[model samples]
Target: MDIQHGSGGTYRTLVDESPLSGLQWAVFVLCFLIMFLDGLDTVLIGFLAPYIGAEWKLAKGALTPVFTAGVVGLMIAGCMAGILADRVGRRPLLLAAVAVFGVANLATAYCASLEALVVLRFVTGLGLGAAMPCAVTLVSEYAPARRRAFVITSMYCGYTLGGAAVGWLTPIVAQQHGWRAMFVVGAVLPLALLPWLFWRLPESIGFLAERRRDRGAVAALLSRIVGRQVELPALPEQQKVEGNPLAIILSPAFRMRTGLLWLANGAGLLMTFTLINWLPSFLTFKHVPAQTASLSGASLQAGGAIGALLIGWLMDRFGSRKVVVGTYLGAAVASLLWIAVLDRSSAALLLMGFVAGVLVMGGQTGFQVLATSVYPVAARATGLSWMQSVGRLGGILGIQLAGMGIASDVDPISLLQALAIPALVAAVAAAFLHVTPRHVPGNAAVLKGG
Candidate 1:
């Protein structure tokens, strides 16, 4: 039986049934690279703060606003971009976002004063914030249903890998070429990839079909996916709902899951941003060498990369709920262990960083996968962006408190121990999270209610 000649099938069915194609792989790889850059650019500032501060004779926590500003940009972008992507197309928003962050970061390299850097970092953050959810939404739409979790999670590994790369790259670049040169490195690479991304990146076919424009383009993309020329069937009618997409996500049908998801995401990111933004500084405070501190801090991201892949694989095998809950709980244990062993030796510190990365980073990525699974396509971007926005807010809060604590000479070990609290909260939230059946498209009942 020729499956490509099917008389009737949903886009989901076709993709689920088909073997992974070249176009699919291309989409993944491109999105992966974008995520890689996203991680790199976002983390670059944190890693360079100590150097930047020394040059300016700034106070210990003076860069806190700069850090908070970028996260604010990210939060705002998340609040808006997802809704925008849902209305306009994903491709244009993505392009604009990349351009915005690239240019802003480039400007950051030449910043002559603290105020200028803060404003530019915020602008760059807007681009970084907008890029991630859009990329995730695109990948989810393109992915086969059965492999969606693993595919999205693996794609996200690019983010961790990018962050990890900065650990090694920052020390060398900041030492030899100067810290400004490091920003140039981060800015130039993404800008260089811009033309290629603009040329090759495909808009979501599901988005196209939902909007009922560009059927020819959709068919062309679909044909390439299935490895045969095929006619486009009428897409299954999407369930339409009234009111804002944001309101819809919080409606009765979705309220419970959405709230729990937000809690988990927020708690997870609180721990995430705290560590990523402050770990190097904390190590420096502990009398570790600047270069070694950078490397040790980076171990978090390296571990996260491994964790993302491992957790994604596990989610695909067992289920998201158990895997997520266990991962968060394990992260809590790891966080406690980090406090215990980080004072032992450099090797112990590195080992604990990796272990925490595996669980914490993996668990955080799992929340994204879970979010993508929970919302229907109509609201996926909005749901994701809002969830991310909440998480960004948590990150902002964490950074501020950590900065204040460090400035006041609070114990770094106490802060490290505090990481376990969020992990435990996330674990509790995950335990209560209910997943929609794998066979059913997300929120069919809710949408159909209208």
Candidate 2:
């Protein structure tokens, strides 16, 4: 592709056609790793649930709040950070989020009671919540338009793989050392990556173009992405420095699209997180052994990691509308299969669980990619953040619903039936993925490349 000289249009055109540079790859990997750490930190507790219950001699409902606590923190922080990142910047908030979660998780290793566990989980949630929307915004802005879905979805696989790691290693670690050792591993790893994030992570080019007062910083990054010395244009839009950044996403022009996107995502999260946080315990409740239960849960995540890669490719090839709708419907079908034989066989449990993971996680992955494409750069972070914030509410509710099911002695098959409703709603509403952002000055230029 030939480089042109002029305003930021040249920069946008250059990136749209240009091959991804080494620097862009490094940024993707860094985002992937941060999310990987988040996955490990977030899901490790689910794998440890049986052990924790055994050690504390607590009732099933006792751990329900523990499960929802971090997610609630995550819910709050995701909304706050998304809005804040629009005004402040993505890089600093991301770094702070990683450091906060890493240290908080390290502290989680020392919690002795339910109260202490809940408090620390909430703090860690704040960091975990903050990292994701910022990461999504960074990756979406940096990726070229043609390959955007595939690249961002591939990066999200790191998160699913992280959750899978907890499942694969939990039995061994707990058997040899203890469940606390798993938290130690999670704590040490993200903290270790802080320096690399500092050195390698680049702020979103679009963000710099949109927000930075410093021309040299934008020029330096463009040089790296463009693979040579490059003259850059002025910031694409002069900073208005105006009203609440998040309110822009909620403005009337975006009201319908935003609401529907939240509905799809919230429903998706309710389905996926319900399975992830409760699958192991659910299986155990049916008399499956703890070790096997952990493996079954891991299989679900493994399927999700694999499914995300496949769904992303299909989305890039076929478009987000079909792929996103199909994924949720697939989850619905898999849930139907589970309802028939769920309580009876161990073989059925793992196989059906894996299928559910693939479709449900893949669908959720599509929602994230679609969100990155939905909003203008001005409120992109807030848009993604709020979408995820609503999703986290679903996750928290999923955990609570599972607890309630357990308390009421609701059978596994019945709960599976209830889970299928959201998948159907998401499938039906996938049409909303094509909704346009509010019309604004320069949106055509900014959205054209995306």
Candidate 3:
């Protein structure tokens, strides 16, 4: 059966065999691979850092600025691409991002000097940064509202798994071949995924509706999932077209929520990158073997997977803000526990690392769910991108701060204790997040419309 909307748009009922069809599953799998490749590329540098430093005869702190440069590039890319995706459509932006990063990875493998590598890595980071928000927006839009968080968290399982894969792959490849082999692996994997993305990935139906003002696409997608054609009302005037894209997000309605999301993202990313980039090194400094340190670092990703799964269910039951605030508080306690207790005992440290992974990584997962729900269909991608971009800046600070803390006389345990401050701040911010009913207007609108 097919139903037509008042706006001369029609939707056909999808077959009812599954909650989501095989096609939807295929799209999810492809998206998972894209994110997996992205995760691998993003962390590839840290895995090769020691080798690069030795080969280039660089001093310990000399390469610090270069790492920061790449992160800055990622921040810029996420912010810029996010707004652009809302304008151009999610699928195209995602494809372009993958292609750009894949080629950049290839170029990076051949860089002969530190300067060249820095430039290439920065460019690579730009592409890497854009892919994430686009992927999140696409997956979130396709998923049923009730299941959105679960599907998103499940997709990111690919990312954590990819990180673990790299942890295992990079050492063996680097040992036999060289550091450059890692880049070669990074460059090739994404290229393989690009073909499937171009062929299989559907442009987000919701995104297409807002862009082309075609209610048909939205209705069709909804019909497919719901298993029966359903009429959709015309968009309210307030939800109608606007010329300026940024104006939509900057409107008074979204200002406070946007700021809160940015804070949440920043704190989350700071904690994430700090651990990814420096945790292994810190372990090495404390007399752990290199292999053991890398393996221990995997606990973070493992914890992230567990956290992502748990928080998604939690958010569905409790609310995004509650889950986020609680996650931050948990992360803070975990960080302190790691420093004061876990670090002294290897077995305890691994357990604590896993727990820290769940809380800190889980917080970001909750943030993504919150960001998608807060924004309207018209500006969702832009909102998500901006939040992610702001978070990337936090990641930059986290990486540099950890480096500086280590270079100075600050003990590793003390630095871990200090890092807990940001997590605590995030918890406080999460408390302030106004939990508006789904599809309701701003706090003012809640009262006025009521």
Candidate 4:
């Protein structure tokens, strides 16, 4: 019933043993809003690309670097935040992340040229990249074990919802106020939420309780959550977290899991993003009406949202290993189903797209839980961030490769076959990444169970 407070073990148990408090809900809600803003701002540029290109009278491909610039920024900043958050504090980094993207989105409304836009996009990506890993890590640390994965995944689902919302709003906003209006809304929401996050969001309890002896602050935080003082056990003086974040993940204890996670994440994003970026255009080539193609894309997002939630719940219930492996295999089957739906009815395409999302998108959600579980709290933020960084790189590579193949006039069917390989590779990698019940030497409790 009680966590003996000496090290990280007591804190994780304290977190796991306790139920969700009002303060914890506050953290989740705030993180979800950050993620929602992250999603909205990230997708705005993509939705506005056509208008921006038309206004500038540039080739369609000119915006490619603009997109890549953002992804590159995400890769760098995500890793940096991960490395820094444990040392710096998740709350402050999170606020700064929101500020970065929120201000960037506002500035985007007045962007003057492609060059300016590229710079702004990179800044926006920095914010987006920094916010997400911190959000997930904080939420995971806050949530109880029974629902940690589910809460974390649901927190991330805000991004997908935000992306979907932008799609719906783009047409109306672009029609009435022009492309800039989309950026305006994107900026306003995050800016509006900043005050609330600053006022309400508390630092992670695990962060405070494990980092050092701040008994008064930790006790006060417990009071906020459970409405009373939490009894503390006599504990040794805890050491401050040290070492380079990147190096921590590469240590012998974490090296294998890190490698597998990178493989799973990289290949997962490679497969997933290729399908996301290309599916609508590819469907249009099958003579599906453009509207239908758009709707089919919607189906993928909706399916992905559902898949994200479902995978999290399943992983929490059945454990990460089985669910992740199965989800990846399901994705493989779904990819094969995709090949069959070519030139088929819109209904067929939509159905298949939804299935593909449930498996592929869902699998990625499962991987997030798995990857975050391997490390001790010390390297958690860096581990998650690095995994995302690798995923972003893989996404960039995958999308670029798809673009090249399409430019070379490769058949859609062949392109899909190429995409399918990565899903299988993800499955294989996940199958190898298992979580055995293990213990850390000095964390004061069993710290390695998922």
Overall local distance difference test of candidate 4: 0.75
lDDT of candidate 1 over 1-450, digit per residue (tens) = 112211346566677789999989988999999999999998888899989999999988999999899999999999899999888878888888888888988888899999999899999999999999999999988998678879998999999999999998998889998899988988898899999998999998777766666878878888888888768655445333335778868877778888888999999999988888888988888887898789887898999999999988888887887888899898888777756775687888888778878988778988888888788776788999899997888899899999999999998878888888999999998887755233344533221211
Give the Å error, residue 200, model 2: 1.1
RMSD to native for every prediction?
A: 3.7, 3.1, 4.1, 3.2
Ranking by TM-score: 1, 2, 4, 3
**Local error of candidate 4 at residue 89 (angstroms):** 0.6
**Candidate 3 segments exceeding 4 Å error:** 1-18, 213-239, 340-346, 435-450
In model 3, the Cα lDDT at residue 263 comes to 83
Best by TM-score: 1
Candidate 2 deviation (Cα RMSD): 3.1
On the 0 to 100 scale, the lDDT of residue 265 in model 4 is 90
- Ranking the candidates on lDDT from highest down gives 1, 2, 4, 3
C-alpha local distance difference test of each model:
0.84, 0.81, 0.74, 0.75
- Show pairs that collide, candidate 2: none
Off by over 4 Å in 1: 1-8, 233-243, 435-450
Q: Over the stretch 323-382, how does candidate 3's per-residue lDDT look in tens digits? A: 788889888888877555534667666676678778987677887877776776567788
User: What tens-digit string does per-residue lDDT give for candidate 4 at 3-32?
Assistant: 333345565666666778888998999998
lDDT of 2 by residue, 15-96 (tens): 6677899988998999999888888888888888888898899987678888899889889999999988887889999999
- lDDT at 361 for candidate 4? 68
The better candidate by TM-score, 1 or 2, is 1
